[model samples]
Target chain A: MNPVELKYNKEHEYAGVNGNIVTFGITNHAQESLGDVVFVELPDEGATVTAGKSYGTVESVKAVSDIMASVSGKVVEVNTQVLDAPDLLNSDPYGEGWLIKVEADDLSPLETMMSADEYEAFVATEEH
Target chain B: MIGTKRTPIYEEHQAAKAKLIDFGGWEMPVQYAGVIAEHHAVRNKAGLFDTSHMGEIDVRGKDALAFVQMLITNDASKLHDGKILYSPMCYPTGGIVDDSLVYRYDTEHFFIVVNASNADKDYAWMLEQAKNFEVTVDNVSDQYVQLALQGPLAETILQRITQVDLSKIIYYTFTHGEVDGVPCLISRTGYTGEDGFEVYCAPEFGRQLWRKILEIGASDGVQPIGLGARDTLRFEARLPLYGNELGAEITPLEAGIGFFVKLDKEDFVGKAALQLQKEQGVPRKLVGLEMVGRGIARSHYPLQKDGEEIGFVTSGSFSPTLNKNIALGLIRSDLAVQGDVLDVMIRDKAVQAKIIPSLFYKRG
Candidate 1:
């Protein structure tokens, strides 16, 4: 998982933007902290997602966590692989575990997102 | 770790890169490799657990048996030497003080193991109750550490490191033995609903014994389990956890542990209240819930019948062995029948669930 290319939300979500199609997923650190994901409740394609709002949820045996959006947009694609095999979030969080693709309403939020270094430092101060 | 206590195996857990969590004020490992993996290992092979945080109390005196009888809801007379009894200590109102295991070594000596979260409160309650009897209750929690190696292969794997005749030790019975030169109380008991042993030894030797058990169990797929899996395993077995299933407000009869409560016993603490509840019919009953709709039914989630609140979930999770979302709920006894559809509120939305028998999984 390359951290350099990713922009992070304080809520532990990530955005990988290529043109207007931005990919959304929980970060590797988030998945590791969550343990094995048993189920995922994701929004269908064409659903709207707002920056800093919950777009979906990821659940493990012990806990349920909201997956917040980093970029506001209408969802273009939903990763059915993770919905079918949720452990992809634990095993390959950066690649196969990507949750949704969105055509950005505005890419402005991307500039405000934390870099890998800043995100790591930010997480260090928050209590688990 | 500021004010929380640490068990002797704290270092071992750190060495394993375990994720530590504050469990009942004790800095314990919640998981090592992962919760789901460790859970599967226990169900299929064997898993060793560091349950050293459990509290131990020793009661001694000529009136120990009689005293125990008065304190617990179980029939103490049924216990003989080398036997164990699961009982709930209760308040006069029939509210649970805590659920504990009583190991009867003799008429004058008994060992009680209590939940870690309720240890201090239980000890205080015991001490207060001791004023009525000649027995002396000593909180010997600091003197020892406890470990459970559980699963289908638990017996075979444990037999390699201990000289104890594992075959002779029947369920709910205990014996003394030395494991790899360390003195221990080898009890054929476990919370995981598996055939296994609970080894209690001095705290200083806890790490050595823990490592040795894992090392010897390496080839057999034995792994170190954490609290996450332990709870799930016990829940699947319909074991009543203190705060979850049994509490100061929940009676034993309602918790579905009535089998352990000998209401016919001459007398015990809360006997009058429990007897009355039994005669009147238990108010709320614990039942199993299988999610018919999306979302897991987590603890404290409201359960409803036709939009009216019926009860709440005590414990809920995705069962590793069962491979689905399941929960143990305490609901009105009238609506607690099997196959009844109910609503479990998850995030203010009502999700459909069906009531089922409490034991979601049982060993063959």
Candidate 2:
């Protein structure tokens, strides 16, 4: 099951904030839409990612989609496992598939992120 | 969206919860389950495809052989009864009208299957060309439903339901018979590299046949494949999709299927122009590429050599069978040599790729 306590973005990324460090990955909904993750290209550690900007890309058998950063932060850690085993994104999007760890410049953007219940409703609307 | 066509087995696709997409004006299933899984299923076991959108045209008359010989780039006069020949119908300027398969029922009767998107246009062009010869061209696309049962297990699965001894129907040949009491024409042909059959029957019986085949083959792991895996399967085999590999502007010689072009046997459409173009040499040719960099090279992605644009990818995908990013690109013939290194511009990033032979997969 998805971690219910984590904050979610409309672009289908979930972020877990422990103090100023935010650990984030694409949501289960995103992985479902993009079947069979074959490759994942992530930003290197020490790269600064802006809120509402693309920081990486995920490719499946059929197509590729951009992975967006939900909050302004400097990437402190990159998930090396995902680079070698991309299918982990589909199998464990909330846990071992977590993409990057970033130290946030401000936690204000986290306030604007939706709760798990709100994100579910948002996905329902998007499907329609 | 209002007038897009639907095939006889459209309901079957819906029942499976397939992801539908607009392909050549037909609302066809792109995937059921998923593309990679479906692709592997076809490569390892068996998969069924709803190919009803392909257009069938009947060409018959006293002068049918001569008329067909004049129309296509292949030597149609060589085909005997029950044999099928793949050919490209071209314009006088060496531009393709469509790549089609010609089935010889007799000297006076031949059936041509054209690409779905080019159905109306191909019919119109044939009619316009018919004025110079004595023959009748009938577009019978709406009357038949086509199913492609493909893979290693295809023969065993189909043999259980049909009375027409599958062994007698050699590759590139066909025979008429009944499947589950439904009259049909079964051909040992397929676009996928695997050995398979293309079953053509009455439109009304499509759904029944689809379900029965799936039910019979269910225990053997038979899956109802969609257009997504169909494309990848064919692409892996180096089979060209009309709009992508062969188009109004791309000649068969330039596309690297020149073996089908009979330049010496008969004077067909595009013969004179193709002869001249061949003498001067084709400026561009199709080549296969494998991504050496971390990004996928998608269709229409620009190709560069020494930082200058050379060509663009026609079809590209992550090959499930090969487990690599592969692409077919039309680039300058000079740069088409094997092992040549080039760069594909994916979005704004440049990805390194190496030139390889066009055929990516071959069945053992």
Candidate 3:
């Protein structure tokens, strides 16, 4: 089940807010679809990212997919631990597998993202 | 969607929840459990593959031996009964039509197995060449089904069911055998770099034979491997894939399979052009690369030397057994030497890589 507290993007990324900072990571459905995660390419901290823009790539043994940004801001921090161990994304996508933390320019962008119930409905239709 | 052909074992793949993909116009399984899992199972244990998609053409007539000798780049006169020879069927221009195996059933009968995608083309080419000789070329691909049982424990598991003496069958040799009452032509051959057997049976017996082998080999954890692991297994063995390494524009000499082409023979289709290429040396050669940077160097990725595009990668992946990113690229022959540093363009950035030996993995 998708976490009720987090918001989701159509590209399959989830965002959770803490003060003015928002954490970004791929949804559970996204990681499951990509298969075993072998490699991940992430942007460096302090890099400017625009909403809906591709920031990095996630590679499995079988395929590679681009990771798009959910909300626009400057990357404040990166999860080096997850970068070193990519399987963490497969095991714990929500906790330690969070990709980046961005200091949001404004809080209004989160309002445009889908709620947990809406994202679950979207995922159900996609699975069919 | 274009209609995709299904093999005899398509239902078996679907029953196992395998991820099916379109390969060479055939609806085939790319993976069942996972690519890495299946790859390791084949390397450390035994794995079974449904290779029924491979096309088999039969050449039989009084002049079969002489006719096949003239058609392929390899000498067929040296092949004895029940033996197999690997050769590239080339066009007169030295370009590879397809790389195939010539199974010498007898002096008057031969079975030629070609790639699935090149089946119709190869059959047409064979008929065109047979006009000069007195032999009949028949495309009997749908009449047979093929299965490959590979790994270290392959022989042990197969020995339990087959009546033929498995020990007597040497490498590249085959024998008529019965496995659980099903008759098949069992050949000690495989694409994976391992000790294995390739069994050829009738289409009606495919499902039973597949199930029986998996059931018997279940104790050793023999998984039903898909084409995903099949490609990786063969890639690490330095085997040249059809569309990637060998093609209409690529010759056997440039694909690093010149050893299979016998120019010393009296005459063959591509002899004149191959002889000319040998005298002048091929411009490009296949080489192995180990990624020194982060990204995986995939197929068609350009190789750069001193900021100039030198060649492109043919097959590459993160090797499951080695746990490192590696690739096989066709680069300028002079720069194909080992330890040479080159850049592989992976999208927008060039990743550093070092040239290594093409055979990335081999069993002791």
Candidate 4:
């Protein structure tokens, strides 16, 4: 089970908002689906991202998939650790596997995202 | 849409929560726990794989040896009972139709396992060749299910459920035995480069065999592997896939599988063309490549030398064993050398790559 503080995108990304900056990473379910994460091309700091748009690319052992942004914001910080050790996404997706920190353009987008409980139910439906 | 065929263990895979994918028109399990985890399970302990999607054809009659010798590039007469031979079924123009494993049950009976996608094509080709000989070819693909128990501890784990003395079953040889009173054909052959066995049995009895093996080997870390890991493992071993490595355009000699082709054999479908190629030397050869820089090389990716397109990648993946991006490509014989640097264009970027010898992983 994941922590309750974070919000999830329909695409399986988890965003934890704290003040004006929001930290985001892929959920455990997403990591499991992608298999072993081999490489991560993170968006540059200060890059603007729009909701539901491709923010970066994540390459797994099998194929490369685009990482869709869940919230509109400007990238404040990029996780260099994930670029070096992409397996962190598989091991600690919610914590150390955080991909980037974004300075939110508006906090209203968070309301559109599913809460932890709702995300779990959403994942359950997907499994069926 | 192509009709996706289901294997005998299709339900078993679903019950185990395996990720199913359409593999060559077969609804096969691509992964269970995960590709890497399942791959490691096979490498370190044991893994059970449902390989029922692979086609099995039985060739039986008075002239089975002669029939096979005329169909495949390998000499079937050399194979004794229980012995297996690997070879390519080629076209008259020196192109590979399919690569398969032939098991000689006796002088007049032989079983051949070909790739699933090439079942109809391979069977038709064999029938065409067998028209003159007293041979009857039967496609028994749906009648049987194949389960592969691979890895270091595969033998020890399998021995617990079976009565056969697996130790006596040498490599490339098979033995008919019973696992839980169900008759099975067990052979010490695998695609993972590790020591393992492939079990062939009736479709109804296959489920029981899978359950028994998992139940007995669960304590020892035996896991259900899928086609995803199978591909990665085989790729790391540099095992050629039919459509990728040995295609209609590529000859087996040029694919680095000349060891399996019996040039001295009296005659075969592609003997003349292969002999000519052997005498004149093949123009192109398949080689392994290791990415030296960022970006992954995939199938059909253009390989360039000094900005000139030389060849294209056939099969590639991020190798879990090597922790690097690796690929296989057919390049001009002169360019297929070890330590030679090349550029692989991946999404408009020329990633630095180095050509290497085949087989990224070797059993220690």
Candidate 5:
């Protein structure tokens, strides 16, 4: 089971919110779907983000895909470690694999995201 | 939109939680655990693959062998009964039409397996060539399903179900036999560069055979592999794919597959053009590349020398066997040499790469 503290987006990203700042990373399911992560292009610090928009790109061994922003915010910090060790997304997607921390424009977007059970159900439906 | 078709095993792949992707024109399973894991499984143990999406054609009549000989660069007359020959069918311009495996069942009967995406075109090409020969060419792809059991333990697992004495079957040989009472064609050939067998049978019986193999070989660590591992395994072995290493524009000699071309064979299509190219030398050759810096080289990625495009990658992957980025590129014949250094443009960045010989891994 995934940790309850981290909220999941419909796109499979997990964000842990604290006050106005939110730290986000992809979920284990997303990492598994992407295969072995080879490279991560992270958003720059202080960059503005819009909910449901692509903020960065993640490349796997086979193909590249965009990492979608789940909540509107200004990027507070970016994880450089993931650039060097992209496999962290597969090993520890919720912890060390965190891509960025964002200072949110508003926290209301959190309510639109899914809980663990809802996300699990959503994934199940999509698989079928 | 995914414009690929699905095979009979599509539902089975979904049930196994395989990640499906568009391969050629088929919606096939790319991987279940992952490409790396499945690749390792085929290397160390047995891996099962549902290769039903591949095209199978039947040629039978008095002039089957003669007809096939005129269509391919390889000499079909040299193939004995129960023997398989790998050859490239070419156009009149000496460019490859497609690479295929020809199985000679008898003097008058033969089977050919081709790449899925080129099935229709290959069939049409064969029909056009068959007008002069007294042979009937039938595309029987949909009537059959193919299952590949590959690895070091493949023989052991497969021997449990058949009474044909697979141990006596030499490499590139095949036999018609029954597995669990189901009629099947078992061939001792594989693309993973391993000692394995490919089983061909009716679609309904294929599902039963697959399930039976899994049920019995579960203890032996046999897992249903997907196309992800299939590609990586073949890549590591330096096997050529139709679209990547071969196309309507590239000849077998240019792609470094001249071993299958029998120049002395009685006149065949593209023979004159290939003879001319052989005398003058092929313009380009396929070479292997190993990335030096941190970047994955991919298909169509440009190879640069002194700030100019020298070649482009045909196939590339992060080799699970070598644990590094590896690629195959078509470059000028003069520039194709082992240990030579080049640069690959990846996302506007030039990454250092070394020209290595093909087949990054070979089993002892």
Candidate 6:
């Protein structure tokens, strides 16, 4: 189960919000499916991201996948640690593995995203 | 994976919590512990694999050796009893039908192991080629289950359970042996870049043998490896996977396995075409590449040079052993040389990659 406080997107990205600053990372299901992460490419601070657009990529041993944005925002910070040792996404996906942070102009788009329960259900349907 | 074929050891894969995928029409595990962990295990310690999905065929009769010699491009005359020869069986046009391991049981009998997806096709091709000879071609895939115990510790781990003298089975050789009271053929041939052995036994004994190997190999740090690691392991060793590195449209000369082609041998199915290609120079060369840019190169990605697309990648991945991104590509032979840089079209980006020698890993 993912942290209940975060909002989820169908692409399996999780967003944790505080005020207008939101921290983003991939969900546990995403990291598990991607397997051992080999490289992570993320947007730099001050970069503008849009809802549903790919902000970065996560490469695993088997394949590479895009990490989509949950809401349009301006990047505030990036997790440089995960980029150095990308397998942190596999070991601490929800904690120190957070990929980036963005200052959202309008947080209402977060309402459309899934809660932990809804995301869990979405992952369950995908497994079958 | 609905309606896909399942091997005898399917339940064991599930029991180990492996992630299963449909590989060549068979439901097989792609990974168990994880790709990196399993990849490291195979490199540093040992790993076990359920290769029962691999297909085998039996060739028997008075003309067995001649039939095999004519069927494969390699010189099967060098094969004595208990020797294994790796060769590509090509069509008369020089295109490869399949690459197989020819196990010479004797002059009158031989066994061939081929890719799982090409099992039926390889058999039909063999049968079609058998009409001119007094030999029997039988698809024995269903009768046997093949398991690979690979790595430095493979012999050390397996020696604990078997009575056969492990040291006698040299590389590229095999012998009929007994494991845990079950009759099996132990082959020193390994696809991964390690010292290992393959065990072929009856289907009824597969589960027990698989369980027994894992149970005894636990202390030596052997784990059940899946196809994901199997691929990375073999790729690191510069071995080709059938569909990626070879196909019906690809010639053995172009696929960089031309060493297996014995041009000096007697006339065979692809002798004429391959002979001409060898003289005229192969159209393309399979070369190794190391990614210099950020993205990882994947299969079928265009290989471009000076903005003109020349060829495509046959296989590519972030190597767990080397800790770098690498790829195998078939490009115009003129451009393949050590230190040449090429562009791998990864998605919308043209990533710079350098052509390197194919040697990636070797056991010490």
Which candidate number would show the highest DockQ if scored against the true structure?
6
TM-score of 4: 0.92
Stretches > 4 Å off in candidate 4: A1-7, A15-22, A46-53, A70-74, A103-128, B1-3
Model 3 DockQ class: medium
**For chain B alone, what TM-score does every candidate structure achieve against the true structure?**
0.99, 0.98, 0.99, 0.98, 0.97, 0.99
Please write out the lDDT profile of model 5 over residues B63-180, one tens digit for every residue. Answer: 9988999999998897889999999999999999999999999889999999998999999999999999999999999998899999999999999998989999999999989987
Which segments of candidate 5 are over 4 A away from where they belong?
A: A1-11, A14-22, A41-56, A68-85, A100-128, B1-6
Q: Output per-candidate TM-scores for chain A, rounded to 2 decimals.
A: 0.93, 0.95, 0.96, 0.96, 0.94, 0.97
Q: Where is model 1 chain B poorest over a 10-residue stretch in terms of lDDT?
A: B260-269
lDDT of 4 at A48: 95
Scored against the true structure, residue B97 in model 2 reaches a CA lDDT of: 91
Predicted candidate 5 versus true structure: per-residue lDDT over A11-54, tens digit per residue: 78888999989988899889988998877877788899998898
CA shift of A77, model 3, Å? 1.7
Q: Give one digit per residue, the lDDT tens place, for model 3 in A1-128.
A: 78999999888999999998999999999988776788888999999888888989888877888998877899999998887788788889999899999998877878989999999999999877
CAPRI quality of model 1: medium
C-alpha lDDT of residue B268 in model 6: 95
lDDT of 5 at A100: 94
What global local distance difference test value does model 6 have?
0.92
- State the TM-score for model 5: 0.89
For every candidate, C-alpha RMSD to the true structure in Å = 1.6, 1.4, 1.5, 2.5, 3.2, 1.3
Clashing pairs in 4: none
DockQ (C-alpha based) per candidate is 0.77, 0.73, 0.62, 0.63, 0.47, 0.80
- Which pairs clash inside model 5? none
Q: Mark the 10 consecutive residues where model 1 chain A has the least summed lDDT.
A: A1-10
Model 1: how far residue B314 lies from native, Å? 0.6
Q: Count backbone clashes in candidate 5.
A: 0
Give the DockQ-based CAPRI class for model 5. Answer: acceptable
Per-residue CA lDDT of candidate 2, range B11-128, in tens?
A: 9999898988898899999999898889988999999999999999999899899999999999888888999999999999888899999999998999999999999999999998
Taken over the whole model, the C-alpha lDDT of each candidate is: 0.91, 0.91, 0.92, 0.90, 0.89, 0.92
Output the worst ten-in-a-row residue range by lDDT, candidate 2 chain B: B292-301
